[model samples]
Target: MNTIKRNRKNRLSKLAVVALCTAMLAACGSNTTATTSTDSTAAATNTSQTTAASVQTASLDLSNSKVEYDEDDAYSDWNASEATTIKLNGTTATVEGTGAETKDGSVSITAAGTYVVSGKLDDGQIVVNVADEGVVRLILNGAEIHYSTSSPIYVEEAGKLILSLPEGTNNVVSDGTAYELADASTDEPNAAIFSKDDMTINGTGKLTVEGNYNNGIASKDKLKITGGTFEIHAADDAVMGRDLVAVKDGLFVIDAKGHGIKTTNDTEGEEGLIALEGGTYSIESGEDALHSTGGLLVSGGDLHIAAGDDAIHSEIALLISGGMVDITQSNEGLEAGSITIAGGEVHVVSSDDGVNAASGSSDTDGAAGEMPQEGAAPADMPPADMPPADMPQDGTAPADMGQGGGPRGGGMPGGEGSSNNLLTITGGYLSVDAQGDGLDANGGIAMSGGTVVVNGPTMNGNGSLDYDSTFEMTGGVLIAAGSSGMVQAVSDSSTQAGILMTYPQTQQAGTLIHLEDEAGNAIVTFAPSKDYQAVYISSPDMKKDTAYSLYSGGTSNGTETNGLYDGGNYSGGTKVVSFTAASTITWVNESGVTEASSGFGGRGRGGDRQVESTQS
Candidate 1:
């Protein structure tokens, strides 16, 4: 029953249903519907507070975690009458279960059993200290648990822990701002819901966790959630799983001073992985919203994230096959050693590189670009006097990252050893509005199918599309608009036809740019989000030696999706130029077909931002 959510055939957002069902089968051995979207407008913040970290060194496999779905989901649906009731009465609790006993301000469960908890605990704790290898199930039936100086629900040891939320129940758990741990040297159980063993949270009820101390939920081992509604506010990470964090379905509203959801098993093995297969998430975090030390796979869900740092980050592999993602605020929207997008509808608004593929080891990864100290807030980026593009980010500089800029090889000479850092997009629709480089890769990039629209950097230090190695495009439409400086065109080896046009001056924002074929057929119409002096367009309709007319300030009355217009009537636009696309790349200006590298690219971030072009 280990089904993968590789249903990329659902090209639209509605196709997420099919992927969600497959994810449920893989996670819970059941089929379920996707979570509905909420009307909370908290995900609209567009300005980022941090900058992106560059790359170091590491090679990681870009594989999915196909861990088998266990039978934990069944525990949530168990008979309520069979569950032993643990009724809480203010400071003390009366347990009707044989394995539990109440002490001073604490309730200890010593054996594996099904327990129902309700009522209120103002300043007490529930500690499950089972020694034997037996799974313990706890059903929260409208329970309110608050603890001072310790975890509210602490699983010291267990074969497995199940936190089942019964339907129609609203469970609330909170922790104090500090912890008096049993071992101060290690600081164990530092979250509101801290488990030392594998844990699973299932059912449709709501769980509210306020972690004034460290984290909202933290598991030392694998943490899986099949179904639940979680509203978590945390001083540290909202959810942390040492081994793996797998979610089949959930509705989550997360606001964290640290990372929203992350895995931290950076030691060895396949730990530190996060598989977000299905969910509806609205996250606002000071650091990376979704981060993984190993690999991150997001196949099905609706994610609206506003992050101060990177929106989604993985030290190794980051794969998005099917989903809907809106990164409303981020420094670097997506960052990883390798980023592969097979299918999805993604929108990014960032202050730095929108999608960055770089090679970085675990030792070099940190929030806001600097290595973080133990419990300190992530250091912010450049001050008011500094420009974001001029910062000394040594690892991300294209010159040192092997971007040679030519068709002979993507990065290294002859394209050898250029795959270490890569950004691959096979199918999807990605729209990016960035203040820095739009799509950046430290090594190389390849695109076979998809539509990419980038309104890139207005600064002269960054480009709309920046790659260290080479970019191979076989099929897809790519439209990028940015400044004239630091511009890099596609390689001449690409099978698709593309053209780069530089205006005499910077064009204003919302100024429409249109392209029409000789048959008067509109190819593409876009309005850049920022002022741009360069426009690049690559389309399937662009045939070799075929003339196309370019227009400026046009009115497109068609359906618009992320600046690209389709089936629209374009009028009132002045004709700019008429040129034929080369077999690969054609760089044009007011004086007809000009050379691709006019000696303008070698001045900024990378001195070799040069590309060979063909005369149109």
Candidate 2:
């Protein structure tokens, strides 16, 4: 690992359901007394000192989910005789009866539930009728006509629409003067306020719902903005609908060319889910400020997202835990199949593949998407010390090395598609800036705790594995600073020729070194030497005589200056060893090289570094 570049190492480092029956109901509001006492402390973990758990308080009564109105049964409160008040508040009404009373004196709803359309209108044209699965909440009180053929109110049947707008007034009103009503030949005038079902907007006034025929609040099911203050301008997919859209609290503001909030599902295994538990959202998007393939879970919220393509795309699994997320992208700030942080406070800037979890295809068992990459190795196959031209070519060690293909076994390369699509961090407070692949994952990464600080570009210019297609650091306090090549652990294509993994090497003098592998799982870890090369081992695939141990560097009074040429320095004593699967080593350390510093400077070597692999 590059050994501590903390700040700017080039960047890289970055549902469901529903059916619905009646018995449900229960969803109106009020309980957000407001609480922001954050003290994450980077996911503190110190088990084995138990004794804490006792709290209680429970009371529930939601009056059958209240959302039932009846001001006189509606028809703008039955004021016929030519009908024309325009708008009114208090008595709550809006009337403009025309053309045989607009197709025979409408307004006849006999309980099918979900209504909250408050009143007061001027160029009135309110015609809401769902008659069935109910849900329409259009609160536009007096002062918002902006006529051009009228659209003061309209929701025929797409059901579940929420326009809201009166907690403090002025939700949105440009003093009425601009207007457009289409009909020439399918002119598409469906949204000044349109619905497809599933819309949510909390109040405090000034609700601006601009339209060009689609998506300011188009719904299919799942549009939830917890509070108020939303500004939307859409031509398509700006707060769309099909599955999910979320904002737990709000001051949300959006500008879209397309996909400011999208949800689509038809192929690639049906995807659609988005979550942002609290809110203060700002989005400028051309596509994907928050796109969903099925799975996006941000725990708290305070997002400032920008995307020309993908600021936050989710194919499956993106779980941050607590808030304050800032993402900017030309391509991908955060892609997903698996990008997890146990807590929150993330900042990402990307051009492409920043925090990706790739898996649009690659599947072998059921054969799903195709499959071929998960540990890789087949396709050209090389690495066992060469020499098959019938001996004597020079460069030593051939003649069957230790007997046939000698890295592991039976020619390696079996196929049934194993598994890879993980990007796991046990806690959080992460910071990343990437040009590409900062925290990647073809399927691997596990930081048992958190306080992660990755600065970017860990190699991918040819030196191999940039930004993790499989990178691991079992514990926390990881600082992979710029310029590439920090760590890579790839073994299991079946091995071929790679060894020498010093996890903690030492013996005699001052004492210090540790090893494991017998259920304990931690093999070779040596620290104390500064100035580069703290750990570096290559891999072609080495594995042979299982059963290794050296618990502590043996008392070799031999000055130990060859620990792979000085990187392991060695003055007095440092060693603790253990091994079960005796051979097969593929270690690396370059991007902020670990051990001498980066955590674990003393004792059981801080945090998580484990190994107990066995197979003889």
Candidate 3:
């Protein structure tokens, strides 16, 4: 049986393939662009409060933040006769070699190392004032800068700033929605490539940024992106790094209003992390598409987000061992305080809670790396209950209680900021679609393997497995469809094996729930995009007495991808029940192994609250 913290009650919430094939055969046999580094992380950020005793810590322990880099930052095939070239002429910039200077239309540089800038500066500004702590290295080959009033590549003083874009070259940087400030008491040079100190951007060319007066590559300390192919359009924040934003590979395409790659050192111990090891991101943000205040370590990468608010918030520690994420939208799709998924392939679409672990809830939910204050628009999120007009349409009663009898609208868990959250799925593959709470944790949850699938919340206060102090499945496979007033299952000390069916009505939306295995095989060939009255399933081929068989409006040709299925040939559906798994949870309906109720309010722990398992 499973016994990790079913009562501790706090509550809460990519394969970086073959080093991307040896960095694409070393950028096609050294034509340039091959820095390759992605491997080093150690995020555990220390959290406390998880009290019910047991906690061996299932994941998120990558290793002490590796941080390497420096062999002259690994160079990239240079030699325009070994140094300064500058050239760029439009509004004027013909430095023709030696440490640079072009005055008024701008071109500064002041000495240090490799330059090779190349072409056009229209309204001008390539400044990089290197003094005494010099370490500049610019190499934008086909460059193009265009300042309309301010920053068009200004780095005022550098101790480090390597900006190469080798391979087939194509650089461009623009800024101009109005700026004119070099130090308006502090907005100093808002972005369009405005670095103040540590920065890095390596080869394979094709960079494009158009930050209309705000940010698009701002760096005041540590920022890294080991290969290039960016395409940003920021009005505010699209690749910032006041202290750290490492990515060992790259191919981004962002559109930000603020935060789509951030790490503003929020000072307090100054950790400001975001260490994604490799890359292929595609963000669209109005706020948060990878925000970090201290730790957010995605081991490798291939992210795809579309956030209006929070799609990967990490105010402390969030860890995904490898990577291939895809959040189609979000209000919250992976918030963190301490979260850990040991491997890859995740997909979420949230309006709220599709993998949340509320600990300081991102400080106020969304202001992530700060600066967004003009029109605003991301606050809402508190509505869930309204569905109990006297609920109880079947599936064996007891879900709308609330006053003394307990059990009402959602699963309950006690008080105080909810333990330290802690959600752990040991391997990969998660898929969720939520309106709210589809694998939520205020304090405890730990699955031993992977494969989770949820399509939660059709009202009745949000559920499809909400946890507040206990949910521990031993191995893989979970399937949670939504709305049964507030259904929940899994916690007889889980040793694998679980089941909860519900349904007396609503079930339309791709319906099709299969399960088989009497002589057939297939356990849960899915289908559920929305409408559901309930259905939970845990598996390792659910045994005990064996004999399973649940079907329902099916017809599998098989192969399906996110709706599940794998190997065809099923038929019309409707078989409904034939259970036999004896215990560790199995409470069916549509007239089958149904029984247990009067629970789901607080202690579904040892009592199991709803288990029947004896129908065949």
TM-scores for candidates 1 onward, in order = 0.80, 0.31, 0.37
Cα lDDT tens digits, model 2, 359-402, are 43321112122212321222443212232233223211133321
Q: Output the number of the lDDT-best candidate.
A: 1
Pitting candidate 1 against candidate 2, the one with the higher lDDT is 1
- Which rank order by TM-score, best down to worst? 1, 3, 2
Question: Where does candidate 1 have its weakest 10-residue lDDT segment?
Answer: 1-10
The per-candidate count of clashes, in order, stands at 5, 70, 15
Residue-level error in angstroms, candidate 2, position 52:
28
Error of 1 at 61 (Å): 9.2
- Compared with the true structure, all predictions reach lDDT values of 0.70, 0.42, 0.69
Is 2 or 3 the stronger prediction by TM-score? 3
Give the range where candidate 3 is weakest over 10 consecutive residues by summed lDDT. Answer: 1-10
Which regions in candidate 2 have their CA more than 4 angstroms from the true location?
1-41, 44-210, 213-233, 240-257, 262-275, 278-286, 291-297, 300-308, 313-319, 322-330, 333-340, 343-351, 356-424, 427-447, 450-459, 462-616
